[model samples]
Every structure is written in structure tokens, then in C-alpha cells.
Target: MPKLITGGVAVVLCAVIVVHLGLGAAGVGVLDVLSFVAGNGDENTRNVLWGSRIPRTLAGLVVGIALGVSGALIQGATRNPLAAPDTLGVNAGAYFAVAALAFAGVNAGVFGNGGVAFLGGLAAVALVYLLTVGGVLTPGRVLLAGATVSLIGMAGAEFLQILDEHQTRGLFFWGNGSLMQTGLDRPLVVGAVVLAGAALAPLLARSLDLLSLGDETAQAMGVQVNRVRPMALSLAVVLAAAAVTVAGPIGFVGLIAPVAVRLLGIHGHSLLIPLAGLTAATLVLAADAAAQVALPPSAGYGELPVGIVTALIGGPIFIVLARRVITGDADRGAAVVVAQARKSRFVTALVIGCGLLAVAAVVGLRVGDMDISWSDLASVVTGSGQEMANAVVSFRLPRILVAAGAGACLAIAGVAVQSVVRNPLAEPGLMGITGGASAAAMLVILVIPSAPVAVLPVAATAGGVLAMVIIVLIARQLDPTRVVLIGLGMAATTMALVNVMVVGAQMNITAALTWLAGSTYARDLSTLGWLLLPAVVAVMLIVGGRAVNMLALGDDLPRSLGLALGRTRMLVLCGGALLAAGTAAAVGTVGFVGLVAPHLARRIVGTATHRLMPMAAVLGAVLVVVADTVGRSVLAPTEIPVGIVTALLGTPYLVWLLRAK
Candidate 1:
């Protein structure tokens, strides 16, 4: 059965590749490609097949195998099925290295860039591993550390991109996970890495099998757990680096391939590892093929990057899998209950202090562009300052409202997701919800420029919901922490898609830049109306619900309390989806607010309870407003988007929270 499944997959993959080779922006067919390969074809067919198709196919195959093997190695070493190359910060490191090189006007040869990328990948893995290491390596700690590194790396990359537009344009296509073959060296380098990984991997298979039995058991079984682990991780890093060198961090194949193999009942190290490699190769090839043929002819003026296609497909699959894991079929008793603990007096004071900070945020808003005083503010609100009223009502008021609403919604969504997924780091931004929304919005805008403004929000909402559904389903077979890891995979894929769109379509990249930085104030009455209704509905549904309260206890106890697990879970997910999508549609993918607000709320309330949902919402709104206000005023007449400010502020707080815990 397993052989049949693998064989079937192989056949499909081959057919897909053939189709890809035959089809292009210029029309061709299988017969033409075959004739070209045999050197008996027309000039046009020969040029198309040999120059474009063959190289692209080879690049995809090589990169795919590299990523697949890397993912398998990481999962094996960590004993976490969700582990992948990106989990160790390899992608971020490679991206940053390339960005730096490009910014410096250093046009390295393909091999030279590959070498640098490999070194960067290795360095990132080493740093993350060193930071998280104790006597034993914990997958959870590694994931958190990697996330921190990725954030820092991304911020640096963005700064560089802003500083140099020429470099930005050059790196953009590569960043989107392009499989456009530069030369034969790409495949040769990737192939060498895969071969190396294959040779070294079997040496650790016995150790890996023991490691999967848990650290204590592995040690008891005479495995040198620590010694073997570093070696395994090193191998994974090398493989991932090689892949990134060629394909620029095409994500999720590493994640999807091994898991797919496991699902096919190929769990043994010997069988599963090879199967994962093949599956990964096939997936990338198929995606590349689809990018060539499936897209509209007009869409691919230049070659469409394969990464985007994979991300669009992979993100939904990951989300469904996540949801399934969280809502287990067998009721494991009532969701594990968090005690309804009240805040102490000191904590209460802190809450009041934060509230005061929020008031100051309102004042901060008036300090930008044409400054307005408290007197002017009062007059505008009371309709005394007619001229100021024009500015305040039309400009400042809408900006503030959008910022506040978006922040609150995102924060609440983050908190709900983190609680359900049982991970401190889980947020819509981190989990691919933002990416999914962004991609859908980009696609809508690109394909239908004349579409109504309302269509963008609708598209974003649909994409977010689709992603959520896939994640929820995938989570069924794994622990909540694993769900977060899978979500990261999805997030990377979605980001790749966005990059592809930005590069491939050559759209107004300034718009993408603005949205990515999390600017507020795009909201008009129309946007407000669309967002407000959903936000209100979500708040109403979750605010006083017993089921939501029980959910904080964890999944096991809710069932014991007579809550229908599936139904309750679905409701909560739907509510979260609405909250995230509405906020993204309104404010263009704000960051850090969702992550920061709930953590602060939990600090104030001293527990996670659905009753505190209102408080969290309010706090989220306040935090976002303050961040946006700061963003506007920090540079006076010029404005940095609210998203940048929140990320800068929120990331430190997240680190502190994690460290404290």
C-alpha cells in the first residue's frame, strides 16, 4: 500500500513536470519539448525548452529535495514532527545575507552567493541552538529562539530594503522563492548537499529512533543524545542552506513532505527519510509546473515564481490540520480549567497605570502634522473649532478609530489563538493569517483593479477563513505546540506568496510597502462599516460565553462540562477568524498589537478568562492607538506606519514575557 501510494505520487509528479516543460508564456507542447531535447526541433521550441523549461525543472527538483531532507533531519533530531529548516532561522539568515550583499553592490557569482547563504544559514542555526541549549535541546525552546532571530533578521532586511530600492528590486524576486535557473551550478551545488546529507543521515538513524522515545529513554538506551543531536542539526542546516542558496527559502516543503510520508504510514527512519525527499522534490516540481501553466497568460509576463503557488496551496492545508488536532474526537474530560483568579492590588494599580498611558496616547495623536492642543481637541469634539473639526473628523478621528479597532481586534485574536494553541508566541501574524489575508488582497487588487473597495475586505476575509480551517484540521493529530510550529510553516509560505506577487506583477510596490509596515488611517466610513459589524459580532459572541471561559481551562475539561467539543471549537475558531480578518481588512495587517495587548491584559487580570475578554479588547484598542499615535508624532510631519512602532515596542515586551515565564 505504501509503495503504491509513493509510486502514485511519483507518477503524478512526473506528469506535472512534463506539462510544465511543454507550456510557457510562448505556446509549446510535449512533442515540441521532446523534439527539442532530441535536437530535431524548431528554433522557437528549442529555445523555450532548453533555455527555460529544463533549467527550471532541475532547480525545482534540487531545491525540493534539499528542503525535504532538511525538514526530516530537524524533525528527527528534535523529535518534533513539525520541525523544519526555517525553525532554526536559516531562511532569515540567508535572506539577510543576500540583502546585505546586494545592498553593498557586490554581485557575487551563483556559487559565491550560495556559499554566503550556506554560511549564514549555519550561523543562524548555531546561534539559535546555542541560545536554547541546556543539558538537552528542547524543540519548543529552539522554536521560540528561532522566532526571535527571524524577527530581528527581518527588521534588518526591511531597513536595508528601504535604504536601497535598487537592491530591493534585485533581491525581491529571489526572496519570493523563485526557481528560475541562473545556471547549471545551482543544481550541481544543491545535488552535492543532498548527497552529503543522504550519506551522513543513516549513521544517526538508530540514535534518532531512540531520541524519538524521549530524552530520558534515549539516554537509558545508550544514545549519546547531546553529541548526536548537534551532528543531526548540523546536517539539517547544511541541507537547508544549500536549498536556500538555490531557491531563496521556498517554505513548507520541508514541513509538508515528511508529515505526508508519515501519514502514508512510512514512519521508520530508513523508509520515511527517502520517501520525504522524493515527495518534496515532486511537490516543488508540480508547483513550478503549475506556476508555468495554470496561471493566466497575462499574469506571467515574466516567469511566475513557484514559491507563491506552493504557499497558496500549502497554507490552507496546514491550517486545516491544525484545527483537527486542537479539537480531538474523544473528549478528554472538561477543558483543563484555568483558575478564575483576580488581580492583586499592585496589579490593579498597574492596570490603572496602563490606562493612563492610553489617555496620553490621545494627546500624542495631536502632536503630528498641524499640532492641536487639548483646548483645540475639546473644541473639535464639542464642535466649537469648525476649521479644526475638518481636520480632526476627516483625518485624525478616522486614523485613531482605525488604529484602535485594528489593535484591539488583533490582540484579542492573538490571545484566543495562543490560549487555544497553548503557545505563548502564537499570533495571527506569526501563524500565516496575516499573510493569507495579504496575499488574497494582493491577488484581488492585481487581477481586478476596478473591483469595488468592498471586494478587498471580502477577499481578505475569505482567505483568512480558508487558512484557519486548514490549520484547525491539521492540528487534530498533534499537540498544541506542534500546531504553532505548523502555523509558522504556513506563515512562511504565505509570505513567499506575497513576495512573489509584489515582484512578479510589478504592481505599485509602495502600496505593498505601506500595508506591510502596518500603517493605519486608510479607513473611511465604508471600511469602518465593514469592520465594525464583524468586530461587534465577534465580541458579542465570545464576551459572555461559558464555552469560551471553559476553553481557557484547555481542551480536556470543556468536554467534561457538557460542551460539544466540535461545535464549541468551531464557534471559537469562527469568532477568531472574523476578528483577525476584519482587523486586517481595516488596517492593512497591523503587527505586535495582537501579540502585546493580550499579554498585558493577562498581566493585569492575573489569569486567562473569557470574562476578561472585554478588558483585553479595550486594552488592545488602547495599545494600538498609542502605537499609531507615536508612529505619527515620532517623525512629526512625516509618518512611519503604526505597525513598525508596535513591532519595535511589542517585540521587546514579548521577549521579556517569555524570559520571565
Candidate 2:
């Protein structure tokens, strides 16, 4: 069965390669290529074949093989079918390394870039290992850690791109995982390395087979468990990094390829590695072919990244895997609850938070390209001021208001979501609302450039709510962990869709990225109006404190207490989704506000829904105001997006959250 499957995959891969080679802007056709092979070809056809088609086809094949083999190795070592370089942050790490390399103006050749990618991938996997080491390495926990690490790596790459836009011109699409190659030199070099790594991989086949039995069993059987695991994982990282170096981190190929092969009931490490590679090569080529078909090169939509296509397909597959393998219970997760604070202490924290937010707003008004002093500020308020200073404050004032309102909405959304997810670490972004909003907004922007500004926020809000609804319906129950996993998958799918539109439309990239990064740039009172509904929802949510608190209780307790658990969960979740999506519509999806602020409030005032709600709002407001201030002030003209700033703050907090007992 395994042999038939492997051979079938090889044959399919050949067909995909042929189709991929034939579909291009050069008007090359499969029949033309076949006739050329039969010795009836022109120079132009031969030039297209040798110059563009062959190199691209070879690059995809090499990358697929590398990712597939790496997936097999990691899954075998970890004994988790969901394990893959993409899930473990290796791909993100390698991608960031290459972006950094470009930013630094380094002209490292093929071999050197591969080495750098290997280091990045190795480091990322090692961090993931360290984070999950204290636990049993369950699929859910490891996957969460990997997702967190990926967020950090992506944030870093975004920061670099913002700082040096010139250096990262084509980096955005490449970062999304394109297979367009300029030449064969890089692919051939990386291919040789992949061949060497694949050969060394089988040397650990015996140890891996035993290790699959369990560490103690493997040790008892005289298979050095410690040494073998590291060797296999390191080899996996090398393979994954090589693929990134060559093809810009095409995701899910490694994951889909190995998982697909494993379903054939083949378990041998030697056979799994090579067979998975063939399957992966086929998946990559096939996805590329599908991309070409969806948006023909001759149609002028530009080449869609093969990675985007794979991500779109892989997301549902991941959701399926999570549903089957993940128990979706919080039995093993650390407590997210906190004891209530003293009334006086809670009051003090709120006061301090308010003060901080005010100070941040003031600083934002005062410290842009020029400073507006107190006198200038007062004069502006009194309708008499320095012309330039008045203009700066006038421009900054509405944005600051929008930032504060959005922040409060996000924080309350976080509080409402955490109440249900029962994990203080949970954020609205994980609910798929933000991603859905961003995706919808991008689609509108690309599909209808003449869309009214008001239409964007409305479309974004509706999209976000719709996304959350899908996640809720798919889970069919309020399983928090499962919901989170499904949300992640949904978010990936939405992001892939957004990338597709971006690649095809070739929109104004800076504006799109800033919005996607959750910027408050150019936002005014009209945008501020978008927050009114969320603010009202926030007030109502806080007022319904008892129900929100009841949600934090376990299922049986909530039911016994006569709380309509299902209805209440839906109510609070929908409200949270509204606040998050509405805020996203207004500010373009500022992240970590919903997370960091609420979590900090919990630490200060505990998890009492009423107290937590207000405290979280204050803190969240302070966070975004400060973020906006810093974004505008830091590089002066070259502003960092508030989302990136908040990510820098929130990533460390997430890492800490994962390590919590």
C-alpha cells in the first residue's frame, strides 16, 4: 500500500510540475513543451523553459522535499502527527532571518543564507522545546507555544520591513512564500544540501522507531533517547531552514505531506522520510498549479504565492486534526483565575490607570514632528495658538481619542472573552474576529477601491462577527481549548485569503500593511464613531457582571446554579466579538490590548468581572494611547504601527503566560 501510494504521489507530482511549467506569462503550453521535448521547438520557447520554468519547478520540488522530510522527522521524534516546522516556529524563524539578512544589505550566497536560516530555525525550535519541556508535550500545549513563537518572529520581520522599506520591497510577497525564482544556482546548491541531510536522516531511523515507544522504553532498549531526539530534531531544523532559504518558508507542505503519508499506515522512519518528501513535492506543485489556474498568469493578476494556496487548504485540515486529536479540555492547563483585590487597592489601580492614559494622550499631542507645549495646547483649546502647533495638536487629538476608545473596547472584549475561555491568556484576536475583520477590509479595499471609508468599518465588523460565528458553529460546543485551536486555524485561513488579494491586486502595500498591523494613522472623529457601539456593549457587559462571572465557573457548576450557560456564553462571546471587530474596524486590529491590559488588570484587581472590566478598560486605554504616542514620536516621519508596538509588549507576556504553573 505504501509503495503504491508513494509511486502514485510521484506520478501526480510529475503532472503538477508539467502543468506548473506550462502555465506562465510566456504563453508556454504543455503540448508545446512536449513537442519541444520531441525536437520541434523555437529559441523563445527554449529560453522560457530554461530561464524561468525549470528553475521555478526545481525550487518548488526542492523546498517540498525539505519541508516534507523535516515534518516526518519532527512528527516521529515528538510522536505527534500535528508536529511540523511551520507549527513549531522553525519556518517563521528562518523567514525572519532571511528578511533580516536582506535588511542588513548582506549579499550572503546560497550556502551562507541556508546556514543563517538553520540557526534561526534551530533557535526557534529550541525555544519551543524549552517552553514545553516542563509539561507533558501534549499536542495542544506545544501547538500554542509554537503559535506564540511564530507571532514573535513575524512581528520582528514586520519591524524590519517598516524600518527599511527599500530593502524589503519584494520581501512581503516572498515572506508569504513565493516560488518565483530568478535562477537555478540557489536551488541546486540547496538541493545538494537537502540530499546530504536526507541521507544522514536515515541513520537515526532505528533510534526513532524505539523512541516512539516512549523515552523510558527507548532507554531500556539501549537506544540513547536524549542524543537521538536532538539529532533528529536538529536534522529536521536543517531541512526546514534549507527550504526557507530556497523558497521563503512555504508552510503546511511539510505538515500535509507527512500527515498524508502517515495515513497509509506506514511507520518506518526510513520509508516515511523519503515517501513524505515525494508527497510534499506533489502537494507543493499541485498547490502552485491550482494557484495558476485560479489566477492565470496571462490574466494580469500576478503570480499568487503557492504558500497562500497551501495555507488556505491546510487550515481546514488543521481544524480537522485538532478536532480529532485534541481533547479540548482545560484539565491540564494552568489556572487563569486570580483572587479579588481589596476595594481600596482596586480603586487605586483604576485611578493610576486613568492618570497614565491622560499622560500618554498629552504626550501624544505634544511630541510629534514638533512639540506643542502647555501654553500652545491651552491656546489651541481656546482657539488661539501657534499655527504649526495648533495644526499638530488638531491632527493628533482625534486620533488619540480614537485610540483610547478602541483600546477600552478591546480591553473589555478581552475581559468578556477571558470570562468564557476561562483562560486569562486568551485574547479577542484568538477568536478569529480581528483576522476576519482584516481580511474583509482587505477584500473590500482590493475588490472595490471606490468603497466609502464608512463601508470599510462596517464590512470589517460584519466580517469579524461572521468569523466568530463560524468558529462557534464549527466547535458545536463551548470547548474553550478547541475553540482556540479552531480560531487559530480560521485566522490562518483568513490571513491566506488576505495575502491572495494583496498579491493579486498589488494594492498600495504601505497602507495595507499599516492597516493590517493595526495602525491608528490618519484616523479621525469619523473613525471614532465606529467605537460608539462597542462602548455601549462594554457598559452593558460590565453591568451584567454576575453572568460574566458565572461563565468562569465550570460547566456543571454553571448549570447547577441555573445559569443558562449556552445562551450566556453566546451572548458574552458575541458581545466580545462585536467589541473586537468594531475596534478592528476603527483602528485596523490593534493586538495585545485585549490580552495584556485585561491580564494586567486581573493581577491588580483580580478576576471579579465588574472590577476587572473597568480596570482592564483603563489599562487597555493607557496601553494603546502610549503605543500611539510612541509610534508617532519614535522615528518621527517613519512611524511604527501600534500593533507592532503592542506585539513587542504582548509577546513577552504570552511567553510568561505559557510558562505559568
Q: Go through the candidates in order and give the C-alpha RMSD of each one to the true structure.
A: 5.4, 1.9
Please give, for residues 1-661, the per-residue lDDT of candidate 1 as tens digits.
8779778877877776777687666677887876766878898887777677777788877788788877888889877654677656787777778777767878886667777877777777876665564422444455666776677556656656544554455455566578877566667766776777876777777888888898899999999988998888878877777787787767668878999988888787776777788789889887877776655455645656776777676665655544433322123321212233457554464477568656855675467767777777777767777685457556776677767667768877876666556555667877767777877888898899999988888898888777777677766543555566566657766676776677667665555766776777555555577677558755665564666667656556778888786776666666676678767777876776667776666666654455345566777777878877776776666566677667777767655544442
| Candidate closest to the true structure, highest TM-score | 2
Q: Per-candidate TM vs. native?
A: 0.77, 0.96
lDDT by residue (tens digit), candidate 2, 378-461: 888888887887788879999999989999999999988878877665688866789998898888887889988778877887
The residue-level lDDT of candidate 1 at 125 comes to: 80
The whole-model lDDT of each prediction reads: 0.70, 0.84
Q: For candidate 1, what is the TM-score? A: 0.77
